[model samples]
Target: MQYTAMLDFRTCFDARKDIASLLKQEQSSGVDTGADTGVPRQVRVLGQERDGAVLYTWSDVSPYRQDDVVVSHIGLYEPISKVNTVLFVHEKLVNLVNCTVNQERTLLGFTTQEKAATSSSGSPSWHSEGRHHAQVYRSYLAEVQPANRVFYLNIERDNYLMVQFLHGKGQGYGDTSSKESHMLFLIHKELIGLYHMKLSRVGYSGVEMCGQPRTEVLAKRFQWAQWDHQRQRLYYLSQKKKNSNSKMTFTCMQFYEKHPPEVMMEVQVRIYLPPEVSKAPSTYEHLPLSKKVTDQKLLCEVMTLPGGSLCICYQHPIMNPDDHHGQEEDIGEYDVVDIEYSVFMLHRGTALHCCMPGFARLEAVNIKLHFFPFSE
Candidate 1:
């Protein structure tokens, strides 16, 4: 569970040397090593890691500028097979990389550059447009494998969302094998798109759509979201404004294959702020005034606790506007500032319920709060 050593370029170079020596020995013994057939000569190593005893090295085909590193050609070095497979050779730049929870597949997000076309008059014309793409590749060591395009996204080029992969049993998607299924989730602001791709032993069920892609647009912007793969649930918190008051609403959504996703539970609680404190200003000329505070500002965060409970922590800043009206001369002398914080837990069972009054406190200085998930 803990890392004993860091894997770097040196590790890859050392592994490559060992593999080269092994290959030379096999060749000398008249052994047929057909795995390394079409590896290129020039490649710069980017990253390398080991899965079990097999070493996987990622490299770029062409030399790149140190100021602007744009990865166009990607390759993978397999030590066991003695093969350096080219994963992708693109005309554009690859910007994002994400691996599945099982670390068997890697998702690369990149942009396609617009190619110049020849005009009717024999002049070159630029398209002035580009596209965004996401491609999945097999990261584990294999005999000879090529990258696959699971699905294509039509999102705008400028709006790049982080791609997340979830692998589990496809309950109602006609997948009966014990092999886990693969699905991808992309979040763009308040919109969440879920795409299902069943990965077979050989490869994935090609680029054809397995099922209709599911999308959910929330009413309000959410702070963060957490997915529970075991229970097949998604939880998020959004804030709703009612007149001059605001309340945080927590929602849980359940996913299914045939039926539409449904909300399993929702809870809303009004945020309460402590009373503002007022103090007489001192006549000290050297004192400095406190920074101006907003009328009623609320900061909220959510974390998942152990035993399937949700913990929400929020802070409210209390400031007195009337005390600053005539005290501009002695603003630095008044020392009355407070911030109130509250923490509560929501438990789920046959029926969702909120635990009894949780902890609340007021402090003079603003305290940075960090909530540890699944910690005792």
Candidate 2:
């Protein structure tokens, strides 16, 4: 029995030695199958590929390749007085990466001094520094529709992060099919959760072409009306007409505490057009070159209750030669109409109605609030 045990132990030792030799060969081969070892932290250029892919070998393994057309870049820079050594690069700006010692590489290895990140336009300063560092584990790019063009980012107003995209079909000019959708998302400094305007998965009507001419009266119909965070109320503007001959109703839909959570108010507005403007056609291809609407009526339902009010306003005039040059006059004169709406309590539900009346009418409605929700 003792002789048999000795023979088994010898066989196990021989097998262990064979495995270690194979592992050592793998480490030397440098295929990078994700293994870690303690070694000096010097930057090493591991190897290059014929296809132009380069590998940066260090404590971590990183392979980088970039295409043209990406001009701006953002990444982490390790500064030593006047020089910057880029320890990490963000994938979003990886297009600026190059195998040769390029300008970005030069900038990375040389930063004059640490200063507050300055902003010009269309870009912001991306800098992060502290003893404890935050690292991104994984990132991915979203496949957006081709119709989604470019977007503007403004960090100053309401700390707003707005992403505007063209939704649905018919994105062509005079294409009444597709409409612009504003997706609003709010980020709070304290909370990691996202605060956004709630949308109803269902309930809203789709945009429809009314008459034969298909003149777009409410082509881009939905606009932000108001948002009272404290009250948990949100409002949006829309225009609806019963028929081709009927008058148009300016409508407002109020959302409760949660976005698209619940309907708290419904407001409809109708503007009283002046006699001269009222005589205009239901769907006129051209303006009559004069007059404007000046009065408004509100049929509002707050929560579940109903109430309304009438508003009368004055007519004003303006002269702008660039707008239109009628054959009647060298320079045409038109009426400038301004109407304002104010909400009052007493009803459980809310409603707002607005109308514009005139042959050559120009309307401007101003609603002043503590914080403006929409940006051009």
Candidate 1 structure quality by residue, lDDT tens digits, 290-346: 101112133445555666666666665544456456544554534445445566666
The RMSD of every model to the true structure, in order and in angstroms, is: 14.4, 27.8
Q: Against the hidden true structure, what lDDT does model 2 obtain?
A: 0.25
Pairs with steric clashes in candidate 1: none
* Cα lDDT, model 2, residue 20: 29
TM-score of 2: 0.23
Task: Report the lDDT tens digits of candidate 2 across residue range 266-333.
Answer: 55533322333323311111101101111121112222122232221212222233555665454333
TM-score of each: 0.44, 0.23
For candidate 2, the per-residue lDDT at 53 reads 22
